[model samples]
Target: MGGSKKLIVCGGLFLTLILSIGATAPKGIRLGKASYRKVTISWQAPDAMTQVAHYKIYRDGTELGSTASLNYTDETVQPGTKYTYKILAVIVGGGNSEFSSELPVRTLKSASFENNQLVEKVVDSFHDTPKSDLNAVSLISAIKAGFEALLGSNISFSVIDENIVTSVVVEELNWINTVTPELTETERLAVQSEIDAMMDSSFAGNSFDHMYINQKLTQLGDEHWGAGNRTAAELFYEFSLNYLSNHESTVSCSLARLAYFAKSHLTQDSSCADISESLSKAKACSERFFDFFPNSAPTSTYAKSALSQPAAWYFSYFPKMLEYSNYDALFFSTAYETAKRLVAFDPADKNAVQRLKRVAAWELVTLQLRFVDEKGNARTGSVKICNVSAENGKRDLFHGDAYVDEREFTLSNGTATVPVYAGHDYSISLNVDVANGNKLKFELPLFKYEKNKLVSYDYLTNSFTETPSSQSRTDFVISSTAYPYNLRADRGIDVFDLSWDWVAPPSFTTAGFKVFRGNMEVATVNKQTVRLPLNNSANEYRYKVVAVDANGNLSSTSQILTVYPGDQSQYSDFFEWMNRYFGDSDIYAGDDPDNDGVDNYHEFLNGTDPTKVPGPTPYAGPRGFYELTLEWDAVSNVEGATYQISRNGTVVGTSSTTKFTDVNLVPGVSYIYKVKQLTPAAAATDWGLPNTFTTQKAHNYEHADKVQ
Candidate 1:
């Protein structure tokens, strides 16, 4: 009975295996012509299988290797090889289904005359077909031939309906709507005809009303307003407007153009009231245009231009009336806002920054002067001022002692005083540094002085002078004439040598001096001669000279002297080599040191030459340890040598050696190593190309325990 049970159990297992194979059978298969030299076979397995171990691929009854994915490529098959392939779906339970239906496949071959000749013949025959005999057959043949040609040449082609083609062409010509006045009558007529035809075509909806309205508007916008049929153009534009009143986009564009023309033509009119009304209408139209075409570039540009005009018109009235106070506030506000917007729109707009500065200067006329002492302490002084009533001008106030109170003053402690004039130009000077001989002399308008009272002459002028007061007032004064020395080295020169001429003011005698190197004052120079010590390693250096006067008056250091190193004669060669061989500057500086298993410098110091060619250095004993000895030909003019060893492009060790034996390396592994040589001048030679070697696998008896 026990023997019988064993037999039944074994039979049951066999039956289960067969059932698993049947359940895991592939349900579908597919094939496609993807490329040459390969064939793809894809299959879908039955859902009853939980895990598919692999699909066994077969061609012409020959078994190929199995893969887990449903898709497989028979890469080993040669091009033009014809075969029938099927898949055997295998389950993880050691069972597989029978072969799938055989699918015929042939690998692609190189182009031959047979394929091209047939396609050519077909196309030529189709083209030769009589027009009366033209049919689907000829059309299909021609299309197929074209497709074949395109595919073989690796080019792309697409088929589109007539509607898309017409739309593309019409949209491309929209820019012609804005023609310049310079266009001749013939050119204008031709353009108008073209626009009419495009609008009348199916592409633009064949709307005759739209075409008529557009033509009328275009006539009004063409040529110089007064020169070319102004009456007729106005009539057309009016008629166009009546029809396009409800058409927001068209109506807005027409109104804006009309307003622009009116403004330009009525510039010399006795009254600008009508022009202002036209501008208001234009602004309203622009608002409507924006609503209709919010993202349109042309519409947005028109809106911005329209908005800018009203402000300009208002400001123009003020200057004409000479009502400076009334218009001053308006001008300042408008200028400020416009400048801010311009800056926000185009951060790099220098014109906008300059405009802002000008507006700020206009506002400076309202500032009051305040005098301060050496410690920024306030001082009591009476200033008499006067103003000059010119357009954008102010009167200058003078003191009883002939000091100009209209000017701004700067104290030695860094405080400033600027006079204010409402609408006139005033010359204001700042009394800088009173206690010490240092003084800052600057002249700014009452308005501009507020913004920059400490500087002399608004950053644009020269020859600013200040007189010292005998009242024993403590103020910081700056000399008007301060010229700093500038030094720059010639290119390709590694070291910089510099000298300059210094002239001291007659009122001030030279007391002590300091020479500045970088940010630190390196030495005191009583005499003019000074030698600057520099490390040739750096590319550039800057120096300055500080001079002190006898009365404790300190002047800012001389202008910075810049020095550049190296006579770049070798730059061309260096750049050429860098481009041709290095390809990248960063690549040469990568951390890989040695061509061997060591750092380049370390290898050199260990008596190993880094520039040596790499080869196999095998160990003689157990434990798979080997020492590699690297050596190379000595480079001429090299004072001493440093070496690095690299394994597989990674630094593993460095030594000063003709050869280094690497003992810790594993056997049976391939390694690529290279070396670099360092010269006495600290320049490094390019690493030699790598050499590859594979260590022999250790014998089991050599290190039997380690191997196991």
Candidate 2:
């Protein structure tokens, strides 16, 4: 009975194993022929022997349907939406296969090809309005229409689209006519006269093409504008506008042309009336453009470009006009009002912010200056700060120069409060008139603030010896130095462990140490050590340390220590490589971060960065004489890295470079191959997506009838 029980248990284990066997999942599922609204997915059958009734496709975990064909077109996909897909083979008899690897696909976004004609229609509806009705809305519509129609589908300016060749030629003609010094005013006028006569002849029996006439007149107007002939440019622009104003397609171009003509009147003139009239015209056109285009629209960039010129003019002349402010404040006041209007329209404009910053004198930052006596007691003195970044008499015509003059401050209890410009550099000195008008002027190091923050600061030194205040304070006043020293960095696989030495000054306790990478502060640590992650691509790093006392007093910064990394540690472990590249050690073995179809563990074994899309996959092609050649891109970053080539799930050969030839293959046999990058430390690499090629068949020589 005991023997019988042992045999039965062994039989039961064999039956369990046999029952677990099922169909295999589909192989080589990949995208093909994708579009904005549709995507086609194709895959190979699990095997030739397995009777697959159909292949089941799942999108985002929902079963779409089953298809007998090898490819499926997903027409229900939405534009710009990302979807996950997986495939499984349904066996003919009973059990189904496991799901294939998930493929994440994103559909393309729609191009900017719609609703453009609607903008044109809006311009045409208001084209016939009276001069009194030429408000911001009507003018802006014309500008938008003009810019888009002139550029014609090349709004991004990446490439000059062939469709806008006519417009480009017209612009080139205008450029040539203006900059050519050989062309006389009489000669230009004669040509304009002939064009005008031809334009007028169009109403009669014989006429020039209205489009040709319009383009020529506009070109002449642009030439005149460039030549500083404002009156001529305005006359030509008006003539050009009259010809095209009635046409739906050219109305916006006409209006924009006229607006540019008006703006051409702005010149460096002493007369305030001339300046105001030209500025008002430019401001109206620019404001109209801004009001019409929303920030999120693609055309909004053109609007910003339009407004930048006027805003720049405001900045250039505002200060210059201040010189005349003493005679009449109206000049400066008008410029100020224009600035307010521009800011009110688009507060996010960067040019407007710069103009305001320049007009407001400077960014104000309140700084505290501290001092101590030779006895280590609070020393009271007077402080003087010199504006080293400013010129003596840089006056603005409109707004007076608001330079920060050198001033003296009284130090109370070892500290004095003073106001300084944020971005301006300054040199400071402290005077303690103690003995017979004997003044000890401590020459302070120059420093600066930006955006109301103290970016850098250094301690003061006496005139006798230019020693740092930290060391000088120890010799003259304070008893000890608190700055850190002896900073050492130890390189790890993915991190650098930084250790330093710090000794607190007398009566001062350690608060924290600020770690700086170059001039930027990276971290604040209470301990003497910090572990910073290493960047794999960077070969070296510079570090400095500064100590903060418990009383919030900062010491002098330590000497900069540059650390050069030794050997790369990512090659030591797969997880280290993943963490170094992706900043994620928790990534699963099968995760594809860059969506190049190869998973992480395979990527690690192959010596490729999981965060970056890898280069070309392996290629297998059948050569004549029953042989196959396998080729792949060589892995460059990993030193001494080779490739392992496998055929039909078995290791066939190893290559130090990128190519390997396989011989002694069976004729007419199809083989699937996989290639993996192998570093010196890599023991084995797992299989990934496969590439297949069939060997050339040998000619059969045996006779069928057996008569010979």
Q: TM-score for each prediction?
A: 0.27, 0.25
lDDT tens string, model 1, 1-708?
Answer: 332222112111111111111011123665532223455666777576457788898888989878888778666665335687888888788888777777665443222222433332333333222323443333433443444453443212122122322332233223222331344323433654675577445323323333343543344334324345443334334444533343444555676666555555544343545544554454454444445445544324444443444434433333322223333454446545654554454456565455444434344343434454324445432333334333232211110122222332333224333334333345344433323233333333442232323322222122232334331122322233543233233232122334444556667687766776677766676666555544333433667776778776766566566564334564455344434534543322112334556543344334444444333332222223243334445544445566666777687776554455565667677667776654443545556556666665656687664753
Candidate 1 global CA lDDT score: 0.44
On residues 1-708, what C-alpha lDDT tens digit does candidate 2 reach at each position?
Answer: 332222212111111111111112223776543444566677788877889989999999999988999878787886546788899899999669989877666553221223323322333334233323333333433434444554453233122121233343334434434543442333433553685576455432112333544565566556656656555555545455434333433434544555666655565564656665666676565554433334423234444445555555554554234331122245445445555555555688766666555544433445655555434566566877777654433343123354445778887776666665444567766565343323444445464333323222223221122223321121123212445655678775446789886666666677888888877777899999987766534444788888888878788777567776656554558656666776645355566766878887778777656665543357864375567887776545666777777788789988887778998887678888877666554432334457888877666577622321
Q: What local lDDT does model 2 show for residue 571?
A: 52
Best by TM-score: 1
Q: What is the RMSD, in Å, between candidate 1 and the native fold over all Cα?
A: 37.5
Q: What is the C-alpha lDDT of each candidate?
A: 0.44, 0.55
**How well does candidate 2 match the true structure in TM-score terms?**
0.25
Candidate 2, RMSD to the unseen true structure: 40.1
